[model samples]
Target chain A: QQQVKQSPQSLIVQKGGISIINCAYENTAFDYFPWYQQFPGKGPALLIAIRPDVSEKKEGRFTISFNKSAKQFSLHIMDSQPGDSATYFCAAESGGSNYKLTFGKGTLLTVNP
Target chain B: EAEVAQSPRYKITEKSQAVAFWCDPISGHATLYWYRQILGQGPELLVQFQDESVVDDSQLPKDRFSAERLKGVDSTLKIQPAELGDSAMYLCASSQELGQPQHFGDGTRLSIL
Candidate 1:
């Protein structure tokens, strides 16, 4: 079973617009939620992360809004740029399993300049 | 900045051939992981190691896939008699310790004919 589920397999946004991607997880044991960005021919890079204790975390133009009670989290990119076109994956990890991550399928975002 | 290193950025092998990929984690990092990603999907963990010992490998196809981290620094993943279905991107990641964010390498893309 897929432990994490992501919505909008693909997305398109104009430059300067806000691009959002959402993810939901089933396991309540998950405490750490992170987002990764991957470009073609490269590995996924850590974008932003949040712990269950925080309702939101922001890093530069990237922000992660987490709702622990709803078992959901979303990533928001302010002023999306063409360079932001890539695949994004949301992941969760629990303390009990040595912090092994379970990932969402992915969301391919395209930012039109 | 410290980063994970991987060799042979891309490889193409015929079905039934043997293949191997190498990874070198950041210095002093004790946790290592190997993940497989199919097209349009998120990466899935195949094996995880804490130093030279494997902590999890339940998703690995033991009959044909094997991994080793002898010195607790670098790792090698091998597949014998590969199948067409084995074509995917093999990614290696490392972390300082449990619960820490993981850093990923560019990954080795494998194509099985």
Candidate 2:
């Protein structure tokens, strides 16, 4: 069973537009949500993250909107640029000793110049 | 900025051959993870370690795959008699402790012929 599900396997947006990716989880135990960005031939890097306590979190041009009641979260990029084109993955982790992460299938975002 | 390190950025081997990958987590990090990412998919955890002890390895294919963190700092993952299906990217990540955000390495891309 897939613990996390992400929509839109791929997306394309014009530069200066807003790009959005959505994710949902079935495990209610998960409390921490993180988003990662990866480029071709490179490993994934942390982009932004949010907790159940907060409804949203933003860093620079990246933003993560979380809905604890719906067990969902979404990533939004404002003023998207070609440099922001990459694969994005959403992952969740529960509290306690186990820090293992459950990841979504990922979305390939392309920002047109 | 500190980052996770992985060796052998790319490897090409024939089926049934033995292959090994290495990883070094960021200094002062206490948790380490090994993940496998197939094309068009998100990374899946293969094993996790806390300090020098293994915390989780249920998803690891014990019949042909093995991993160890002998010194609790650097880790090695070995696959014997590799199969064509084993062609994927192996990623290593580390965190300061359980439940913390993880930092990832560039990963080793393995191609089985």
Candidate 3:
């Protein structure tokens, strides 16, 4: 039923600019939200994650802003670089179901240098 | 620096052929996951295992798909008489335990003609 929905199937940003992707989830049971980055021909890599208890979590230039009340979350990449060109996926996990992750379709990001 | 390992980075076979993929989780990780990712879509879990036992396989197509993890370490997923619709990327991930972060392998791309 597409528990998690992501927006802007594709994105383009200039180097050093900020890049953002948004996601919304329908299941209130979800407590853990994570973002993953995938390069072509490779697997998705864990980027950043946040729990319902935290409104925001930052790692290096990647940040995840989560709003539990709204059932929404977003990823922000500060000073996006060419190296950041890849696909990003947002996922939600509910502990009640053994932490099975439900993922959003994905957003293809391109950073032009 | 440890990572999950998957064999046969890419596989191409005709429809109705039997195909198999293998995965080896990181050391000390007890939880394993197998996911299928269609082109331009997020990965969906096909099965999950904890210590050689399946914790979930609700999304798995039991009619043609089967997976097993023996000795609580490596796992194998097999599909018999594969269909054209089965062409996709097969990803394997592992975690230390329930609720922990998962690490993914490069994945095996399967193309069924």
Candidate 4:
């Protein structure tokens, strides 16, 4: 109930290929889902977020797919590039909370040219 | 680019030593947070402050950790008699209002010897 399990502890994708990271959360109280990107030695920053009301949200080359019934969400990266190589984290937050973000262990993504 | 600011990008201390970190949130942000991220894991929330009062500190160690935001603009996190297991990245984030997206700082990488 407290953990958001993410898959593929590490991922390797060829340039221009698609990179997908999945996360499954057990808490149905989580109303907001967000993905964060963190570079080496840097803090994780919000990349994109979506509410449960929306099935999907697209921001530039990144997209978030939410499944209410499945209690799962994913982050999709298109045209993977070396610059995009970084650790991606999937997070969840319950409504009415001021600033609490429960995050997954994280997925290390490497895009090879 | 008004971003959350953190001090002493890195710190190396020995066991039983004391360590401190500072954070200046973005202007007009009323909510602030402190998070600890161990290597190979996602960030974990240690505390949350609303303006000058602490709204939550459920996960805070309490034994050796304490935080405060006197003016609600700048905050500090302190640890006394630090242990080796305490070595990790300390992150600070702030949001404009409740339930809003938070902006994070680069974070302080602490290595306890």
Provide interface RMSD per model, one decimal.
0.6, 0.7, 0.4, 1.3
Winner of 2 and 3 under TM-score: 3
| Candidate 3 C-alpha lDDT tens digits along A1-113 | 89999988999999999999999999999999999999999999999899999899999999999888889999999999999999999999999999999999999999999
Write one digit per residue (lDDT tens) for candidate 4, span A1-113.
45799988999999999999999998888888989999998888899999999999999999999999999999999999999999999999986555478999999999998
- Candidate 2 lDDT by residue in tens digits, A1-113: 99999988999999999999999999998889999999999999999999899998999999999998899999999999999999999999986538789999999999999
Candidate 1 local lDDT, A10-79, one digit each (tens):
9999999999999999999999999999999999999999999989999999999999889999999999
Query: How well is each residue in B1-113 modelled by candidate 1, as lDDT tens digits?
Result: 98899988999999999999999999999999999999999999999999999999999999999999998999999999899999999999999997899999999999999
TM-score of chain B of each: 0.98, 0.99, 0.99, 0.98
- Model 1: runs farther than 4 Å from truth? none
Ten contiguous residues with the weakest lDDT in model 3 chain A: A63-72
lDDT score for residue A60 of model 1: 96
Q: Which 10 residues in a row give candidate 1 chain B its minimum summed lDDT?
A: B94-103
Instruction: Give, for candidate 4 chain A, the lowest lDDT window spanning 10 residues.
Output: A92-101
Error of 2 at B93 (Å): 0.4
Runs of candidate 2 exceeding 4 Å displacement: none
Candidate 4 lDDT (Cα, 0 to 1): 0.93
